[model samples]
Target: MTAPARYPVTVQFGEVNGEPATWAIETLPEALAAVPLGDHGVFIVGAVDPDAFDESDVSVLELLAANAVAAMDAADRRRRLRTYEDALKNVDDMVCVLDGDGAVTYATGPFVSWIGADDLGDVAGRPLDALVDEADAPRVADAVAALTDAATEAGGAPEPTRTVDLTADRDSDRRSRHGELRLSRLSDHGAGVVGSLSDTTDLRRTRTELSAERDRFRRLFDRIPDPVIEVVLEPEETVIDGANPAFEAQFGVDETTLRGRTIDALDIHDDRLGDP
Candidate 1:
């Protein structure tokens, strides 16, 4: 007895003895057509009788593959753009995009609420300088004008960006808010500018309080009756940075001359009264 041939098979339409018949194909026939999706896989559409495939079939398959890849690329771009927009909307900082003429194009995030605006449209289509405090408006305009001139000189290349600390006036309450504004050219062709505003009102207030406290401490230190000296520790020795007036009188040295001198330089020993 002979062993039966074991081969992978696929069903195909055919005719046997002038009657319709189905037969198993061991391998892909010459008339079979297939299209490959790049890096994905191949699609076998159908198989025909031998010699039925032509050059047109190959062209059609190539065109289909190209179109499929292009469609996939477009979809990917849309997905990424959506993700970026979502992140911008949810961020805590205030972000705005401007047009080439300095009109506001888009604004988003917590800054809208701080400005007491019902929506982004409240500030949109307005000049960026309009929101700045009057005292700072001229400075901001000058900086932007300089940047624009530089971009022109460079044949439309983007100019270096700038950050300015300024105060903004809110429309709703007319309240002044301290913020740091960062400006950057958006395109190589001088298309527009993007601005990011960071609120620093609370931080500036805290810093002011700390500075006043430091000044108060310095005044009290100067008025104290006890002699006091401030020294800086170094690898070789301790150097006196400053000394109070009482310290100067006790040591019989001018406070200015004593500064920057090592503490060991002021050697003192009991000599006039012996053991007293």
Candidate 2:
């Protein structure tokens, strides 16, 4: 096995006495020259003319160094972008990317499916508004504006979220479904927006059902003949929130005076009241 290198690996410019053979660096007795390519590596040219090699040759090699470094940087960027695209494929949420003009440029497989598109090709280059329902256009516009404005103010801006009603297809506009949209500026991707959409149909339905049940319970609590008091139970205390008219009259205490105070502070509950 090859032993781990103990010395820090580095290259020195110009022809100098060093262990080039062990490091695999080419050395020429005639003329060996090199230019630093930033931290990437060094551009080495050997077999240079012993007499013709001068400062002008170093200047030309410097020019080549700039172009070579730029090529390496571009190649590195392409590699990272490929990795990002690969990672996005494994994400479950619907992912959408917009261009500088607010036109849809890219969509992951999940996003394409969410839009009811046959494939990504069908969804590209369309304005975001084209894919969403007309009724939700105003909210979409506002969220987009907020995202863009936040991005402009700071590179690391917080994501803005909004709930938008959606439809299967652009032409349908039925908008029978809903999604929670969390969006942020993709300054790294472009001066564009990258957003994930999660379906919230079940959540919205649950909220609606809960509101209806609360209304019904409030009606029942108001009309019932028994004395009733609504209290928020906590680990340390039970805070009185509401008292029915029967409870207030029977206890000889106005709800306004009893409300917002814990049971212990009021000192009215008997030992039986704590059994439940």
- Return the clash pairs for model 1, or none: none
Q: What is the lDDT of every predicted structure here?
A: 0.69, 0.69
Query: In candidate 1, residue 2 scores what lDDT?
Result: 33
lDDT of 1 by residue, 90-197 (tens): 776787766555666677857666544678878788766675677877766655654554556657644568787887666686656788888876533334566788
Model 2 residue runs over 4 Å out of place are: 1-83, 148-175, 188-190, 267-276
Worst 10 residues of 2 by lDDT: 20-29
Per-residue alpha-carbon lDDT of model 2 for 1-276, expressed as tens digits? Answer: 342354333454455476343333343335777999876988887763676568999899999998988787656645654555677778877988765455677778888877667787887898776777677667766566556544456555534444455544334555456676666666432246677888877888899999999999999988887779899998989999988887776667888888899977765658534455
- What is candidate 1's TM-score against the reference? 0.57
TM-score of predicted structure 2: 0.59
